[model samples]
Target: MNSPDSAAATATAFDKARTGLWVSLQKHLTTVYEAETAFAQAIAFAEAFPFAASSASPEQLDLYWQRRRALRDLFTDETNQLDTLNKAIRTKGYADAEKKQLYLLLLGYMDIAASIFERLHTEVPKPLPKDDELEETSARFERVRKFARLNVKGIFGLLATAAQ
Candidate 1:
């Protein structure tokens, strides 16, 4: 159904894109973890100082906000790239519908990650959660990252199959 040359080219391009996405995602995750950690530390500081119990110290908030902004910017770049890639795939008619399904699955993973990052980066009028709650949020994020890793591997496998 598809030419070998076309498939090879698609595989190469997909590999390159996936690698970039992987690196960016890793950095994004690290940034998110750092932000959460900073917030948690702030919460701890607040608890120790009853006067600041209502909120974290200004320095801590600033650090968290900085990391959150970084995360938001990184995620925006990645999603933009993905949207472009999706459009390219459609234009090129890469492989078949089956291959497209793999891409869609990868998109789903991104959507879930977006939901997590959105909450972190949004300007909601809500106080940061307690340390214990923040740990749970971190756990959820880690789980999503792990699942995304698996999804990425699966997509690579699909590409391999298509290449052959």
Candidate 2:
């Protein structure tokens, strides 16, 4: 019963919605990638700090602590951003075909993130030497890595179902 012009307009609107979804997904993926990089840097710093033959000066210790804090903050911010993006997508609706495509793309990214996190968690070093500082750092890294893996899996499952 819709006129040709009206149908065309509807199609255009759907296209725009899909485009918006893609943009949002891309932004979230970028944030995730950045968070991953920050986490890797934090791990490297932590690993190097403990192995240095010379005693770490107070300044060096402070710098390592600062890096750890920064990485945590980055992860928090990225998580918040992902939540916002999910709300936006829900509000926008996903009944249209174009929107379904966007949902699939998001699912793909979520899968990738989950896989990366799992690999990192399994590969990361554990059981630090008797040093308390090294033990604490290793524990923190393990905790975050585990959290990331679990988070990614949950997100991926949700997105996959939503896309379907």
Candidate 3:
């Protein structure tokens, strides 16, 4: 019963949705790369000197804290962007195919983020150990990972139903 123009419009919508998803995915990947770099820097710092040693300098402590703060902020910004992108996708009417594709892209990024968090948490450097600091970092990483995973999964599920 669908008219030709309606079918064409639907195809256009799908294209738009795919493009938007691609852009968002690229941004998310960039964020992931930044976070990975920061993690590597942290590990390097931890390995270069003993954080737990009594002789650890105040400057060294500050530098380490600064790197962690910067990385955390980057991830937070990325998460906020993803939230915004999701909202946009929901509000903008698009073909079912497009919506499903977008949802899948988001889900994939969430999975990647979760994987990165798990790896970081499990493979943390053993030297220069500060239990409290490590715990805090791990907690923050898990928090973001959980939020992204839950939201993406929910949206993907909704899109799946819509597509059907």
Q: Which candidate ranks first by TM-score, i.e. highest?
A: 3
lDDT of 3: 0.61
Residue range with the least summed lDDT across 10 consecutive positions in model 1: 45-54
Q: How far is candidate 3 from the true structure (C-alpha RMSD, Å)?
A: 6.5
Model 3 vs. true fold: TM: 0.61
Give the Å error, residue 56, model 2: 7.6
Q: What is candidate 1's lDDT per residue for 1-164, written digit by digit as tens? A: 87999778878876665565556656656665665455444344433322332365577667655655565455555455555545554465445543445455555556655565555434322544444534454555445444444445576776887799
Shift in Å, residue 79, candidate 3: 1.7
Residue 118 alpha-carbon offset, candidate 1, angstroms: 2.7
Residue 141, model 1: lDDT of 46
Residues 6-59, model 2: lDDT tens digits: 878877877887677678667767766776665555455344323442344566
Clashing pairs in 1: none
Task: Report every candidate's CA lDDT.
Answer: 0.53, 0.52, 0.61
Could you tell me every candidate's TM-score relative to the true structure?
0.45, 0.48, 0.61
**Model 3 stretches astray by more than 4 angstroms:** 47-57, 117-164
What value of lDDT does candidate 2 attain over all alpha carbons? 0.52
